[model samples]
Target: MTVIGIAADFDPPHRGHAYLLDRARDLGDEVVVFLNADYTAHHTPPLLPYRLRREIVLELGADEVIPVRGYHQRFPLAYTVPVRVRLMAEEGVDVILDAGPSRNLDRLREHVERVLEVSDLFSIPPNVPARNVVRWLAAVEYVNRELGTDVELLLIPELEGYSGRKIRAALRRSGYSPDSLRKVRRHLPRETFKKLERYLKARTPPIARRKELLDVLNRASSYELCSIAHLNTIAVREILRGRPFRSERQVWGALRRADYGSVLTRLALANTECRVTSDEIARIALSWCVERLVPENQSPDSMYRRDWFVAALSSHGVKARDADRLYKRADSYEEARRLARRRYGVDPGVPRFETLIGEARVSDGEYRPAISANGRLGVVEDGFQELRATAFGATLLRYVLDDPFVDAVIRVEDEEARLIVFPGDSP
Candidate 1:
């Protein structure tokens, strides 16, 4: 049997995902799919829990699906490729297909028959228009180029662009509206969606939770209503957002997780005509609120940036603790780019670092030194010297007091305990 293997996060398999699996099947006599375990996707939270998601893929037409655990303490995605390759090798895979941009193709090719890149067809051909083809493709190219690989791009114009991310967002919406569910169906394969609907029905909270919220909504402010209804204050505030529930669609953003019951309970309460399903609420929310990543004009100091990032995320409904993790990631991204530029004149477009990246918590105007490759801490002192970037105690200094025009080089020495930079230059 000619076995083919492919790996994906597949938190919830959508139409585009179905296309890839179909292609994988065409490439070999048998197909095996590697499902990324939940809690492994670094930046995004899973829409469904681990076991539920695994069950979802099993229904989505994967021939042989196996969920794998993470091996690395950090940078699991990078490490995931090796684990997949090893497992697939044992399964006698003839070709390991990589359709996504994010994967270590170079390393995988060494062990497998060959790492074959599947052409992602569809300018978003069917189901729903792609979430954002330009942005998603740019991210893809950046990853491949950073790793110095030339993966073939295939064009299958008939295949549609089905985004699981959009589908998941659509699911987290206000009252379960039939219209919303109808819209979602357009983007999902009929069989897959039918199964999904059945699963969603099972997950809806009982109606008792709805009646409790309705009574509280009748007489109290959102804050007071939480205590009266035994609901979480933050979710209630988010659902209300300081305004009365004027329309179900208008408030779907806040209603996504506002109640345990179906979103329709809130909708029905807003106006008794609501007869929606949980699936509809999600679809409406996705059509209304699109996710965008806007770069922050970050502070030079890392700790201050954390505060700024937290405040920004809080306003958009992310909790305080989760916001902290996001801030750390942003800081690490910036720090890597800054360090890489100072050392190697060329930028790889994305970062893969060896040093443990962290943000300094306090600002004392002291030059934050990076531990060199050889394990020596960098320091700045007053003297004239020059050295290599990766050397221990070797430093890159900027913004110092000196004769502004004298063109002085900051002295860096491996053996020196103190780093000396007579100010005047800015990096």
Candidate 2:
């Protein structure tokens, strides 16, 4: 049995996605899709939920749909590509099908190899059309070398005149009404258009939590705001100075003043909405760090420390090559920070909280008025002290806030506290 693989967000299944699925079906007996989770690669919520997107893909002829989570929220494309390639390799995928700008596979592979030779974190050459095509090819070659996998890449010409941005803009402009759906009908498949119409009528679009995001940004202290991902020191200062934001636009203006581009600004807002801290991002990155990056004979403790250092540096915008250099020269995280500053003039973006000392479990609590407008404030007992806490994220705020019992790791700074709750188990 031949297994073909594809990785896509498929935010809302469109004509391009349908084309890819059809191509993969023709080339292989099984088509396996690795779909992005609720969040897209740009660290924003998709227009549709993950379940809906998966259902549409299956309806379009995917044999299996696997959720690719954790990495996309924090890491760059360079870090994520290798992880996806490894997932395909592990899933027994024989060939990966993708749409690229050019049909010249050898040329694309050559471009990827050159970029990989320089640094894995470096972006593909701008002159190269369809950089993601080169990225996937590079990742496959790297994974094959490191893990001895024999997966192959198959590139097909990308279908033009289908744009997710254009479709999304039309939907938003028309308030996601049936009329807007009809306006962008040609960009979508027949099934996609029908399903989307039903979805728009039955359920609200998967838009960002603007009210909750604004409340957090307006109320959070500079120190607390700085802890969120994509918010640098300058951004924090700008946000703090422009407190009491009445609308999302005001907050965006502050970020613009802070020199944040469109994507980074959106990411900062999304992170604030989820209350995603730098420490949490570092922890997530550590989980994704491939074992093959390190030697086999290294002790578990040493390997963990090295991975932690790399993850931390990556979160701080340090390139992979520089992070590796710092890992070899420094004996501890503090030493690594010093070395990075001395050599590369890198400033530690977020203040590192103390390591997880112990665990605490929270019991039932009633709703109380707090920082977030959604009334999610509560009290959590950590060791001998009780700390005031506010929970964010859709599922967390909905269920855990009022649940009878939950286990979490509490990290505190001064009187402010943030909870790190891992699903299914206590950290």
Candidate 3:
């Protein structure tokens, strides 16, 4: 079978990305796009997560969208290209596609049996020639070694876009304001722009303010602080050590100047070492739930102004179990379900999951269950279905659903709706 694969970071995918999909669709029966993971993106890691990026590309009509975990690894790097290529081969990618200027031809031939260069980057505004050349050459070398003679490249110049760099810069400079978003809208596809707009409105700043970080750390755990502080675990951990649990004064001294996320965390925790209350913790947990609902939009605080989280939890009608157990983070979704089961005896599931009774069960180490939403028990398969699971309400459903297990039975108590999940579970 002939399969086509294209690789890109597509941070907020532009029209150029859609052009590749359209062309690839014409070239092969299946077109798969390999997206760069968050850590592997060309610019700062504040770029969208791999899942979100894959979702955007899939919307572009690619048959499949797989994230390239460590995008740039090759000879003289951390890992060998052959190993990576073998993995792609396992996915049945017969040809890998790329795009660039006409001069990229010579180097393109070295990788893959067939190569497709979509254009000479004509639609792109001119930029630093030397840097583009270096990046282009390095990509060519890496792709050549990665795909070798087994893949093919075909050149078709039809892609157009506002360079990714420009969009990111505009977003940063504008502080994601209305006019800036409007300007950005000119460069992205309609659906892509919609997602981007939501992201801009809801996402945390790529860098945290020193004052804001200090305020949040005071009431948040090292883990919670990481999310609020927007720092990695290591940095957060480093800022959280001491004798008799170091004083805020000492921590502040150590954090005089550091990554915004860490600095923010230390500052937030400065005086909050032992002052965090249950209400504050509950607010944090609800915030986490909001994050799960809209992973791209990190503004869980938005739900609070309207009492949305509390109202939703109250609707679940949980009884006979302490809801606080739900707020504890789980290492994984499956673990979250397990913790729920331990707390509630019978598994909490949508009335229309695998059986009419809606008893939850683990599948592939994941909780695959229907969720009761909008007064209807609906399961989000490839798409959402409003109908019952089966005529008898007991029909076993196919396909795993990824909505939160807590969706079906939330308990609103103690002035907060504590979401149930296992410890270590990220939204």
Top model number, lDDT: 2
lDDT of 2: 0.65
Q: Write the residue-wise lDDT of candidate 2 on 1-427 in tens digits.
A: 9999999988788999999999999999999999998678767778888888898999999999999986565545666787788888899899999887666767776788776564343346557877877877777877788779999988888898887878887887777777678789888888788788888888667663468888898777544664566676567667767888998879989989978888778767777888876556545444444455222212223333444455555555677567877666555556777887777676443332223222223443311111222222333233123333332222222222222122234444444344444321235
Q: Kindly indicate the candidate among 1 and 3 with the higher lDDT.
A: 3
TM-score of every prediction relative to native? 0.36, 0.68, 0.40
Give lDDT: candidate 2, residue 193: 84
Ranked by lDDT, the better of candidates 2 and 3 is 2
> Number of clashes in every candidate structure?
22, 0, 35
> Sort by lDDT, best first: what order?
2, 3, 1
Best by TM-score: 2
Local distance difference test values of all predictions, in order:
0.39, 0.65, 0.43
List model 1 lDDT by residue over 44-162, tens digit each: 33444556556656666567777765321112122233334445555666566645433443432322221112111111223322322222333234334433333232223334466
Q: Residue 9 lDDT in model 3? A: 78
Which tens-of-lDDT digit does each residue in 1-427 have in candidate 3?
6899776678868877777788889889998886766333332343556666778888888988777663231011112123334455567787766665556555434322111131111111234333333333333433445345355444566465567778777876776564577877777888688776776567644322234434454444442333321233333344554222234455545344334343244323422332332233334434433433111111223212112222222235443123323522443334545666675453433222112223222121222222321223332334433333332222112111111111222122332222222211232
| Stretches of model 3 off by over 4 angstroms after superposition | 70-86, 103-149, 158-161, 205-427
Model 1 stretches astray by more than 4 angstroms: 40-43, 49-60, 71-76, 100-158, 173-179, 204-427
Candidate 1 is scored at a TM of 0.36
